[model samples]
Target chain A: MSALLDSVLATAVPLDRALLLAAVLFSIGLAGVTSRRNVLIMLLSVEIMLNAANLALVTFSKVHGDPTGQVFVFFAMTVAAAEVAVGLAIVIAVYRLRRTTDVGEVAALHEIDYGPVRYPQLEGQPVHHHGSSGNGDGDGDAGETGGQPAVASEEAHG
Target chain B: MTEVLFYCFAAVAIASAVIAISRKNAVASALWLVLMFFALAGTYVLLEAWFVAVIQILVYAGAIMVLFLFVIMLVDLKSEELAVMGAPRFRALGLLTSALFLAVAVFVVLNTRETFVAAADTWDRGGALEVESGSAAGIGHYLFHRWVLAFEVTSVLLLSGMLGAVILTKRRLT
Candidate 1:
């Protein structure tokens, strides 16, 4: 066993070991993302995946003795930082609208519970809601905010 | 010596990464991830890329982690309260699937030969001359001379990210 250890360390470390580490990190991230129901944790898993890629980039950069790999890593980090900014912003926005960030719950899907019976118009039509031009721009804001527009319009009329 | 250092750092990185992902508390998880990042930076040093190693610690451990902590605090550290009943079984399945993928990935990685071993020879061609390729000065030279356009684009990307975060978090548009 000691002989094997000595032999392994005798040469420059094979790139294989570094690559294997990256694979393990990536799998861990994949598992975390799949199992976690929380949006925040899922984002954390994505960050893990990004870091794993960075590890591989640096490993390869070391192999070629080229600065290009490091440059690629720089670009990747830039993109990752941007992604986190935008993604967290969206998550926060979603959480504001619905108090929870659970993926399984039907917070945003509440409208689907209403079904076709409420609308009843043009279920038989192939286009689905495209023919509802008569509803006009007035209903557009109402549809977006649920009930907020009705109050604003009523205040305007008053 | 480098190889020994490589194994030690790799072990630390993987172990901490496992702990990071498995933790239920976001703060604990973030702390573990910070350790993982440090170990990975150590590995970068083992590769003799001093500039990359420093940047790994500075950008990832310092800047990106602060961003993660900011978002975690903003979210109030809430985990989903989805029912516990079938959750364990689902989580176990996720573990099994990822383990299978890890096995396949490791197998493929080991079987494939390194793409360009010629660079190792290049390192031997001229002793002092070859040293420049992996150094800070070398990277900066190429980054400005060869890849200036991409560098400029990276700045624009960060600028847009700042605008996006501020705009999205704004409470009142009026």
Candidate 2:
């Protein structure tokens, strides 16, 4: 076993191999973020991307024989932790308000007015459809009224 | 032997990452992500970044994943809802875009491999020899000395993040 280990250690792994792995993982994570609809899964994908970056950083650190890259990895991990905490909190809050984690249905802030603006939180109820009358006052009032009920309902649900 | 182990870990990491992203179930995805993290940690070990490898397992595989599992359980998504995806065309477009990105990145790495390796070799030869560069002691010295200010700032970032999370998730402002 010792002899085998020594022989293995004799030939160091190339840096690009690890870098290629990082690239592959990062692309996979990107695909996840784009393809998956679940907000939680999207967040997981972001974590995977961060992990891939960490792998690349560690690999370079090994190659250059510097600890600075490792220190950067430390900071990256701290930021990742903080990001996860805030992100999950937001997820919980969104789940509570919308009763669903589907990213498609949680578009309350989408202002494009794409055909009768379906608010998932206000489902199973009459949505006051104030037609965009091409007047600023009417549109503003409609927007205010549209937002107020969602908040009121959220409070009631909570 | 090390190269073989590295390849094994890399293959595992890539496979698990692909599985983790493609899985419909969030819990299964999170579990697979943990496996990927473990594989990544193994690769880090092979690179002799022992401290980083340990932290990779502890923080990523352990803490962050538990937090993910908690959210997954708390969300309690139904099966019908889990079927949600964007239009098939958009899905295909997204996958195609990422595949293109992967191809470009791999191409760049392959082309620059010799230059990068030669530069790194020169730096290793010319720089002051630090035998414990990947060890915890060496990392700690850098972290607490040269990177101390950033370390303090990171603590501040974490504190703010915790406070923000608390405020965001609280039942009522009052």
Tens digit per residue, CA lDDT, model 1, B1-174: 766788898888888877877777777778888898899888776665567778888987898888888877777744435222127888889888889999998888867645534544454464322455656887898899999999998999899999988878766442
lDDT of each: 0.72, 0.81
**Per-residue alpha-carbon lDDT of model 2 for B119-153, expressed as tens digits?**
55665465432557777998899999999999999
The 10-residue segment with the lowest total lDDT in model 2 chain B: B122-131
CAPRI level of candidate 2: acceptable
Evaluate residue B105 in candidate 1 and report its C-alpha lDDT on the 0 to 100 scale.
89
Instruction: Give per-residue CA lDDT, model 1, range A3-84, as digits (tens).
Output: 6644543456557678888899999898988787777667777888888888788777766666788878778878988998
C-alpha-based local distance difference test score of model 1:
0.72
Interface RMSD, one decimal, each candidate: 6.6, 4.5
Model 1 misplaced stretches (Cα beyond 4 Å): A1-11, A106-158, B78-93, B114-129
DockQ of each: 0.24, 0.33
The most accurate candidate by TM-score is: 2
